[model samples]
Target chain A: GAGVSQTPSNKVTEKGKYVELRCDPISGHTALYWYRQSLGQGPEFLIYFQGTGAADDSGLPNDRFFAVRPEGSVSTLKIQRTERGDSAVYLCASSDIAGAREQYFGPGTRLTVT
Target chain B: AQSVAQPEDQVNVAEGNPLTVKCTYSVSGNPYLFWYVQYPNRGLQFLLKYITGDNLVKGSYGFEAEFNKSQTSFHLKKPSALVSDSALYFCAVRDMLDTGNQFYFGTGTSLTVIP
Candidate 1:
């Protein structure tokens, strides 16, 4: 059984550029979540999806931060007008429908805005 | 609104000695408590969770946490520390009563095990 995985383990982009991070959840997982982790800090919730629709996206910082799980398996996080403050690790997690609390995390994608 | 707190910025312990990382949480409902460990250059790994039942819950890598309802605390403890145990620990809380599955995480407490 493979764990959650993210593409482009690392990404570097200039400030004001747009970047999209992808996450592949575990097979059959009905719930997915995205989090942002700044250096020396804990991961913060960004969005959550149940099935094909986002169940809770209130954690999104602003309009520039958006995410979608269209097929209900893979998710993409889009950040427009990237800022230096957005330079951090983006983590994706997935859990079974019965146990949403026991989430399995991906290795994370480190995004650096220069 | 729910929140978690890891009052200690860091905790130091010698190899073979006991260690404890304190965590407290505030919520409006029966809380779902969780502990996660993160190694450098990696993502979070779930250690243990306290949904209900036992007050003391054991987790991977010889770690355990005690959930206290009256005191609003869930302190992680280990009988003997190891150098490999050194990492960042985060305490999270979810208000199970809420319709949204939102989790609140603490700032994290770094553990340093001296060999």
Candidate 2:
């Protein structure tokens, strides 16, 4: 089976610009999550969606970060007015369900805000 | 808040020797612990998980983890080290009782297997 896939493996943009990262979860995965990983650091949670609705958005750093999982399969992480601090690897993961299932991760989209 | 900690930033072991990467977790309720390995420029790959029942859980590539409730730790261990096993390892924990059920990851430990 195909694992989670993320588009635009690398994206470079200027500060204050907008960028969108896409994720395609594994087949039949009902839960999707987004995380940010800085250099020499672990991945930090961003947002999670159960089905079409976002079950948790608390991990989102600020209002500038938003994510949507419409149609219950594909998800998009949108960053508004990106900052240099936003430069990092954006990871996407998915699980069969929300509980104790292990998440399958994608190659991730590396966003560089110069 | 749920959180996990990898006390060691790096671990080095000779090939064919045993290896251990330590991880501790804090959660309000019973924990769902997991181990993941990441190669350079690649996404995280699941190693193993401990939901309940057995304290020792085996995973891919001859990896295993022991879940300790009293110590609040889930340490990743392997019987023998291989040069191919060198990678960054992350420990994660999820509070089963939490409604959101988001995982908390550790800082990550880089493992280097010296040949």
The candidate maximizing DockQ is 2
DockQ for every prediction shown: 0.67, 0.87
DockQ of candidate 2 compared with the true complex:
0.87
Model 2 lDDT, residue A6, Cα: 99
lDDT of 2 at B112: 100
Superposed by TM-score, candidate 2 places the C-alpha of residue B104 at a distance from the truth, in angstroms, of 0.4
* Per-residue alpha-carbon lDDT of candidate 2 for residues B15-101, written as tens digits (9 for 90 to 100): 999999999999998999999999988899999999999999999999999999999999999999999999999999999998987
Clashing pairs in 1: none
Among all candidates shown, the one with the greatest lDDT? 2
lDDT of 1: 0.92
TM-score of chain B of 2: 0.99
Q: Name the docking class for model 1.
A: medium
TM-score of chain A of 2: 0.98
lDDT of 2 by residue, A1-114 (tens): 899999999999999999999999999999999999999889999888999999999999999999998799999999999999999999999999999999999999999999
